[model samples]
Target: MTLWLSSGLIFTFAAIALILYKWWDMQCIGVTPVRTLVFIAILFTSGLDVGLIMFPLTEFGGYGNVSDNPEYGFANPLAIEFGFWAFLIWGFYFLTCFYFAIIEPRVQFFEIPVVKFINNVVIIGTCAFTAYLLLANLPWYLPELSSDDGVVPAFYAIVFLSIALAVYSSSKIKYVRILSVGSSLLFIALIVGMWFRAFVLGQGSPADFFGTASMLGEYFGNLNKF
Candidate 1:
């Protein structure tokens, strides 16, 4: 199988697993489908993106050729994979932020309700700022912060809106609160990975950090050969 296809398979499995986990947990706790579906969607997307990127690199030998012949570790269009993965990472980040801001306090996961509310608000705001750094400008900002030129901005905005709505609608569920915080931490980790990878690649800012972490990169190479 092509590298992109293999990665897609991984993403598919991860998405399914996340959905099932969220549904099962919420069902046991008496949370209805409405509540669980939102969480499932958010997590599934995260897994999907993770699959899209990692599978391509690890399986396909992510790289491209500038000349007629390509060499291993050679730089090519695959560099764009970094940006694509970063975009997905930010998508999850905002989703987590909104969960914390609006959902966590409602769920009563935090002993201090006020603390949960405040933390959620802070996380959401920070996500917004980080997203700007990642999407609007890259090479000028940071390498890992770069994103795919077309879809990144739109996807980020959509995820942000969805999370905001979820937080606003269910501001009083205990389990929601716990999940929100956990999701936020995960999102933060994703961002850190992108940033660190950029630095490793010698990109001064997160802006220049594009590499194969997406199925698209692998496909791009295969297409070139054809």
Candidate 2:
């Protein structure tokens, strides 16, 4: 069990490092200021969700054997806690697509160099993320992902497929013509990141500044609801 946990943790770390490295490269080359902000924002929210999930898991005990005792069981507490985390993490992802793929095209009708650059980054990342599912641990098998908690992934896949179709659509639709392919690629990258951090890491990764804030917000937000 310890070995399994360690392996999962390492997978997450490697995935995150790879992602950050890619983002850093983008930053170094001045890919786009907006793109940088988008990645940073997502990373920050992810950190917080993971931290909140960890606090209870660690405090109760390391993820070991499953038990029925309410005091010892991780399922109930973790489910309740991580559900919100998943909600927020996925909420942002969905909103990103809604704004970028749907709304922006209708409203802006133009892409600046930086915005276009960011769009490319998003596309490439999405492609990589989808590839990871096929080669990595295969998160597609997880039942949880198809359930209520999986709404974000489902929507992500939907948005991604839409982007793919948009790529092949009539060229006169300026936004679709310009961004479809890039959006699809970014969707794949994000999926890969999700697989790495959620399934591989299992929410035990270290905290970052943004992640800390997310954790606090969710923890308190949930508390207030109750």
Q: What would the per-residue lDDT of candidate 1 be over residues 1-65, giving only the tens digit for each residue?
A: 57896676467556655654664444223244345555655455434533453344443333444
lDDT of each: 0.52, 0.48
Q: What residue runs in model 2 are displaced by over 4 Å at the alpha carbon?
A: 1-86, 101-103, 106-110, 138-226
Ten contiguous residues minimizing lDDT sum, candidate 1: 133-142
The alpha-carbon deviation from the true structure for residue 188 of candidate 1, after best TM-score superposition, in angstroms, is 25
lDDT of 2: 0.48
TM, every model: 0.26, 0.28
Cα lDDT for residue 19, model 1?
Answer: 52
Per-residue lDDT of 75-131 in model 2, one digit per residue for the tens? 334444554455544444544544454457668743778878887998779656644
What's each prediction's clash count?
Answer: 20, 16
TM-score, structure 1 vs. true: 0.26
